[model samples]
Target: MAWNEPGGGNNKGPKDPWGGGDQGPPDLDEALQKLQEKLGGIFGGKSGSGGSGGGGGPAFSAPLLGVLALGAAVVWGLMGFYQIDEQERAVVLRFGKYLETVQPGLQWNPPLVDEVIKVNTTKVRAASFREIMLTQDENIVEVNMSVQYVINDPDKFVLKVRDPEISLQHAAQSALRHVVGDTGMDLVLTEGRAKIASDVQTRLQEYLNLYETGILVSKVNVDDSKPPSQVQAAFDDVIKAREDEERVKNEAQAYANGIVPEARGGAQRQIEEANAYKEQVIANAQGEADRFSKLLAEYRKAPEVTRERLYLDAIQNVYGNTSKVMVDVEGGNNMMYLPLDKLAEQSQQRAVRAPSLDSNTLREITNMVTEQLRRDAAASGSTSRRGGR
Candidate 1:
């Protein structure tokens, strides 16, 4: 029936699974022999028989040991292999001490002997700060700043500082406070924010370098700079007033820009017109002077004839514009009345209508009138004398 059941089947006391009939306890030596044989087979070594005469029990063969050692070495080497991404760097430490920094890609180092710490070198990490700081003018201002940084040196980042990000945060706060303290409140709350941000970045980088944090401050942004909430309304009113002042100044400047140009243009035009008038008057005066010089030459040649001609020309000019004429007869009781105005008008009208009636014809008619006047004077038995040489 059962393998361990007594009497009926075998006539033996009980069959021991270990060896034969004696079941006091399984033999320790026999158990050790079985375990050795299985292990030897796995390692490609000969197994010893389960007997005392089986030489030195389970001795290791040289070839089997060599294969085992090689397998162990291969497993250790595989454990040392690691891969790093493009944006990452690895810092290797040997025996818990700083060893070397490794670049990205497949890398291998002795496992359990050298420790590898990976850091993302190209990643841009940010730390923001908002704190109340006193300005140089002893005014309170709320400064909100954000610092962006990256791990430039993986070795220093891992070994030099226990916590690089925390160090960077502290450094940023110190730098921001220092910069804000050195600046006036007006600048911190207005256009001066950009300059303050720049200064903070520079100062923060210096601190990181000083601490060997291996962090590069890429950018610093100063967001909203404002007065505290207790005085926000007052600050807004001030800002509005400042803006109004600026707007008024701009309007005045624009008006001046428009009016000044127009005024200058008008002045320039007047100056040019006056110069033209001056040139015209000067040219006319010069021409009159030349005519007078020529007339003077003619007068010097014949004094009486030139003087009589001048007097006749003056009389013709005077009579040309008059509508009525009254001549005093020499040694006569009544004045002589001549319809000279009507005759001059008729002559002027005939000259305008006829092309043949020119200035020469009008001059001949004037000579005929002068001869008639002389006859009339001769009839009066007197000659007319002119005054004012």
Candidate 2:
């Protein structure tokens, strides 16, 4: 008989263990119990009906528990050893209290009793801040700046401040605002940028030191500073006007510098010329007075002769400069004419034609003048002697 046929072989026994004849599936509880019994047999035990392994099961041993505990302890102890990088420092704390700082390297701390916080001390860090702030001039500007810093004391960085970086940020912002407030907007935007940055850096450092933040500020730089965008054009116009004003002032100064020296030179020249004229006039006056005094002494010695000689000398000097000579013929009706002007004009024409006067020609002119003067003196003497007769 087939196994599927009911009551075929063991109709007295309960149907089929797998319930193959339209009994749907086996009972979940019975299947699970059978699985448990099979597992127990593999482990050198018998199937059990209660939770206590009532039939038979493997027993727990003290040796196994010791092995597990030893493994856990080893893992826990291993976890206590942590590595610190070359650029890092670790702060050691015991039972939530301060202890000592540890240098960078392989470090060990009691896992549960001690806490370690690793802080980067050798590496530089940076933060940037920006704001639209008011200046001492009551002007508004947008100031952008950055600060570079590093952790100097790991203990203070980790324990002294709750949040070191946050405190630094607040300090930096406050310092920047305070410095900006004390400075003029033009300076903050222009030539005073470096100074403002330095001021901010100093102020921030002071604040950090006061708070014991343990952050060393490396540098503070004002990255960007400008007027508000809405009125930037107006500010640019003002700058241009200021530049022009400066240029004009410089040009005027240069012009004055050039002109002032020339004027001073001219005035100095005038003063020197006046002084020279004064000296010349005074010298000429002194010379003339001395000559007159000598002439007067000679006149006192022989009055008549000296007067005649003086008159002749005056006539000679006057006649030497001109080509015309006028003579008064005493008691004579004839107007005696001497064409000395015509003669002089002819002489000048000859000189222009020849370009040079020969030595003999000059000698002849000199002899003629001497003879004329001699004749005049002789005539005056004869007339005086006749008057005496």
Candidate 3:
């Protein structure tokens, strides 16, 4: 017989062990009919028993219901388990309210009873802000800066603010402006930049703390701080002037360094020269005093002899080159009318006397006496001959 026939040989085993026939598995209508029949049997209403007595199949299948329950539990358990990385933290919420914070590791929660929001708490986030702010000197300056922050408290990070990143950016801007407003333009552009950045970080941390944003500001760096580009050249000129002032000061210092020692050396030389001159003058004066004192002692010891020697020296010094002639007017008794010129001539003749000798002494000085007498006789004869002629 064919399988499609109602009493076919294929129907010998009671069709399908699970209850429906092999009509390739039961159709939707057939399955619904079977389900209704099972329900009726379960309630003791009717089954294919052909009696009003309500005897039926087993009420509920224990094995198939247990299988469905076990499958749902497996799926729910998988949903409860989560993994957080080293750089992440998990915020668990119970019934839409924050419950506990979980650190990095494998964690579990009741499936539908709790929810986990994973946050990257250790991740460094950066924010940038730029604005025009007034300086301490009332000058407007535009400043650009970047801030690095990290989530320190995941619970506060998730629940405290609407947008933490945006709030951090605004706080950085406010803190930067506050710091810039208290500083001068020169300081902002130069030495105060680091201080300004530090102050901004501090103030930003305070502000974030106030808002409970749980953002820990690690660093703030000022990228650019200056006047507007339109006046950049003018400010550059001012900077150049300051540099020039410093340059001039350094040059003055160099000049003083070069000149001061040279001046000191010149003054020192002058002092040495004056001291040498003083020493020479004192030495000469002492020598002169010693010579004068010796002469005074000699004069005190032999007054007359010293005077005679001094007089002879004076006369010899005065007339050493002159010839002397002496005339004795008193011997002639001038009543005899003596000739003055003749008498002077005779005295000069006598003053130019020849040498004479006694017998024994003459023998000793004979050669000298003979030469002198010859020269004198020749001179006298020449004068008498000249007078007679």
How far off is residue 171 in model 2, in Å? 2.5
For every model shown, what is its TM-score relative to the native structure? 0.65, 0.66, 0.59
Runs in model 3 deviating more than 4 A are 1-60, 268-389
- Give a tens-digit lDDT track for model 2, residues 317-336: 99898866666555433344
Where is model 2 poorest over a 10-residue stretch in terms of lDDT? 52-61
Error of 1 at 210 (Å): 0.8
Which tens-of-lDDT digit does each residue in 1-389 have in candidate 3? 44444665555444454554643554565455567687866755444542333444544566756877999999999999889999998999999999999988999999999989999977888888889889999988889899988899888889989898888878888888888989999999878889999998899999999999988999889988888888899999999999999999999999999999999999999999999999999999999999779867888999898889779988787665444423223323222222446755865686579454357874666578557755655666676667667
Name the regions of candidate 1 deviating beyond 4 angstroms. Answer: 1-75, 312-389
- Model 1 has an lDDT value of 0.86
Best by lDDT: 1
Of 2 and 3, the candidate ranking higher by lDDT? 2
Better of 2 and 3 by TM-score: 2
